[model samples]
Target: METTPFFIFLFIHLSCLVLGFGSVMVTDLYGLMWIRDRVRFTQVISVSGVTEKFIWAGWIGMVAAGIPLIILKGEIDNLMTIKLFFVALIAINGIILHFLHKKVGKYKKGEHVPNLFMFRLMLSLFVSQLSWWGALLIGFLHRHVTTIINWPDMPWLVSGLILGAFLMIWGLGEIYFKVKEV
Candidate 1:
């Protein structure tokens, strides 16, 4: 709200979120489409590879700026802790997915997409979507969604959101595979 230094950092943090998670939507969407057309697999890998750089850059920027944003809030509360937890998830998931990129690279270069690969990819997608979207939602609601739900109810709402989104994404991945086989 303020044009002070903290708010400036906050704006940077939001920009990082846009850069990182926005790229993820593209990667995830193309990855899903790749099931129907092998050529799309290349797009998934290409786009993801290129975007992953910015995603990581944004992640780092968010972290560097986010700590101050939290400190400026001036109270170490539950909501802050919960948000940090999700941020950690996003970071850890990014680390794991960094390695997983090699598998995707191989797939793009004509390596076989085995069942295990698909399973892992689905899981990675879950973590990526869940962490990025989940953290962003929690962050938003923490800041601006108070009109609908009070802060006291946030933990339960976040829990339900995380679990529900994970299940739905997993189910969709399963359905995609099943339908692809048909």
Candidate 2:
């Protein structure tokens, strides 16, 4: 791999990570602010609406740059596989979050948000944090301490267990909200 191309791809990859993850972090902070009554739901939605573009741009660019980096480096191990799985989960979760954002946007000021919506939003936030941070951690480990860390043998099983736990949490949330309403 040429040094110039490798550096270029790495730069784009890092830039995308910062842009996307930074936007997501800001949006989550605003959501927490709303939950804490430090800000309004409308304000949180506004910030999310604005930052969504950057989030998507960062995700897309990161993925685009990642393929070349993988090829250039020619290092694919169990950890890399796990990271890729996490990236795919992020994409899937992003789509679900986008729709949830749309649903949240429909409420007028002062209207009570539904319990289900709140629960789902919380679930999405949890999943987002898990996927994003998990991917970041896996990438860092693979890049920095490849020889030290012992990655799991079955990457699919690991991915499945992580996603399954998230889904279970979401299902439990749904049940809790339903029971509360009853």
lDDT of each: 0.73, 0.87
**Which number leads on lDDT?**
2
lDDT of 2 by residue, 94-139 (tens): 8999999999899999998889888898888888888899889987
Query: Which runs of model 1 end up more than 4 angstroms from their true locations?
Result: 1-3, 108-111, 146-182
| Model 1's TM-score against the true structure | 0.74
- Residue 58 in candidate 1, Cα distance off native in Å: 0.9
Question: How well does each candidate superpose onto the true structure, as a TM-score?
Answer: 0.74, 0.93
| TM-score of predicted structure 2 | 0.93
lDDT of 2 at 84: 84
What's each prediction's clash count?
Answer: 0, 0
